[model samples]
Target: MTTAPVIGPEERLPLGAAEADPRTATRRRYLMCEPRYFTVSYSINPWMDPSAPVSTDVALRQWHELKATYERLGHVVETIEPAAGLPDMVFAANSGTVIGGRVLGSRFRAVERAAEADHYRRWFVERGYRDVVMPESINEAEGDFAWTGEVLLAGTGFRTDPGAHAEAQEVLGVPVVSLRLVDPRYYHLDTALMVLTEADPTTGRRAQIAYYRDAFSLGSQRVLRHLFPDAVIASDVDAACLGLNGVSDGYNVVLPREANRLATELTARGYNPVMVDISELRKSGGGPKCCTMELRD
Candidate 1:
């Protein structure tokens, strides 16, 4: 069955300056859903090893520990019901991009994940979010779109279309910078780059990023270097363990325990690295960031 694309404007809007000043950044509130039906039933990305055995009990235990860690650090964590037949729904970051209480719902490119758009939309609406902008183009929300400093860093050349970059800018009312992914292993932008400080509230507009340079194209690498000269470049070993697929709160960076080098580098830069074991989820090409979605109000 063919599904008609959600009709919307597709023109690339003019890039604007960063939106919110990071100096006032506060503890971010996030949403996460328990892995009720989490399993790699199909091979979508390079990480999915369906032949390998999966332990739902282990995945649930790890997910709970991660949630507890967030609460322990004094962050508000919200939950949503995981629908059946949507195993990938555990990765809430792909649901949408939230800005100023508005959510630009993701229109997934994969047919297996297509139904996710509406489910997430209803969840937002029921939770009192009125401004939900659905897109016509294929964009994977926070998975392929994230905010760093005042601009939205969008990913393409894999799960997302370059045309969606413009749509996001127009709908989200923030300037978006495009980054192209080269490696199939790092199919999503979140897997290649991690936002460290989105406008450090303590310092000011100063922002930081941790990324794997080789995951991007030559042009994208140049753009990243020009934009963030002091960006933390992850080692090949760390990147292999999905170290770049992490979540940061401007103070604490939550990553997999396998990312030892990244943790050391983060500590050297005066950032606390909280290691968690989400190896079960890693079997599906996701990590800390994939399990959480920041909702900025």
Candidate 2:
């Protein structure tokens, strides 16, 4: 029942020059699924409304633009075939959390997404990933698990079970810091927080992140502040636009176009903000980060 111990404030090091120095972009490999079957046929989250109209064509176009943006920046982008009935398959990040070539597969809380876990696990196995595990506890993979290069920041209370935090730590061999989400709108961890710069022990670079503080419990907020003293705090307006649901390669940050204020703040912090219009996909409570699954190797 116990998870990894949360790092105390006394152990926290000062994050110097997080906003003063220019950020560096590290090339990354990401897995994304085409939105060929993208639609809001069911309501699993607060954002999804079955009564609303959906346009698969718009979703596909927006998805393509996002994929091209990644390639344009020299990041490797891979795709998985979208299943016909699985509309949310376009959100590849929920598939799994891959780190150091090992995959911790997802066990979705909702029955609608339960089948997605198998498909993602199959991809990992087929592509020669040897250490792929399907957890017994309910977890939504990267949807609730975000790697900060030092520890795994796991979320619970909406889509992921707290038990999954310990499971991930045991399987990934990384310390897990559990954060309790308080807002139903920001159900998944990705929606409320993003890693801007991963901790690099070799280079002595501290991890930098951006988050909506109100989305988390008070204790979790304190934990985050201790870990990342220089973390960017997003405003309510930008957070509502899913601004924190972004993909960052240290320097370049890809986020939703509606998050104009956040984009400005990222620029002030020496990070280039690349905005993309994913209004169509947002209907399903997803953004650039949701559609992307980092294949850390």
Candidate 3:
């Protein structure tokens, strides 16, 4: 994969009137898992260090605050019980990708997180999600797959397998655009990119996004530039803080408090930035988006 080119302020795309207009927040339905058994006892990604100290109590508190943030925004928040010994289960976004009541379950690349897929699949089945499917290929669900209204942007090269991209397209029946990730730090696509405003073909409102350009391969960066010309480009400081690992309901964006620069950029783009401190859970490399899974029913 080719390295991404350095983009300066002068090279940034100019914001148009449509981008400056105030955004509308849509009420959504989401699925979450409490960090009842949260911990970083095993190393999987670059953020995990087994030797580092952890506090389950702190993780629980932070996770609760995140859940409350969603409820406060008028979004329905549903939760699954955190299974014992499944430490990373709290990062529920990996559970699956639910679209129009059809669920595409995850097949985790790590053994430590493998069992999580079944639990999430069962949740959808038990809730009467008739079209739920457990993927045969290895994929990390929403952690590596993001819906942009018109197409699904998928990432591979670290956690999720490249083969899963085609598998998801067949399962969801939506066009999939494969983007290769080059950075290990941003192991999942959601860690390096986020969809800010989904496309609205009726209103001619194009999909808007924000991403860490360096996390993607050069060709992937070009694709992103073509798809979203006015996409927000995150700085190194914001990307390191997992700023791009945020959830946006078109208008209100919930993100980590440490990503100050990203918050400022979102505000300039006419989005309401809601900050939450989940530093305790960050020990395992997760944020708001990581903990929450949007359920499109």
The lDDT of model 1 is 0.84
- The alpha-carbon deviation from the true structure for residue 140 of candidate 2, after best TM-score superposition, in angstroms, is 0.3
What tens digits encode model 3's per-residue C-alpha lDDT throughout 1-297? 001111221122334254654476777889999999999989999999999999999999988888887777778899998899999999999989987777899998899999999899889888888999888889999999999999999999998898999999999999999999999999999999999989888878789999999999999999999988999999999999998999888877888988889988887787778888889888999988999999988
Per-residue alpha-carbon lDDT of model 2 for 1-297, expressed as tens digits? Answer: 001112222132222244454467778899999999889999998999999999999999999999988887768898998898999999999989999888899998889888988998888899999999999999899999999999999999898999999999999999999999999999999999999989999978889999999999999999999999988999999999898899988877899989989988877787678888899999999999999999998
Task: For each candidate in the order shown, give its overall lDDT on alpha carbons.
Answer: 0.84, 0.89, 0.88
Query: How high is each candidate's TM-score?
Result: 0.90, 0.93, 0.93
Best by the lDDT measure: 2
Residue 210, candidate 2: alpha-carbon lDDT: 96
- Estimate, for each residue in 45-162, the C-alpha lDDT of model 1 and write its tens digit: 9999889999888999999988887776557899889889888898999988999887899888888888878888898999889899999899899999979868899999889999
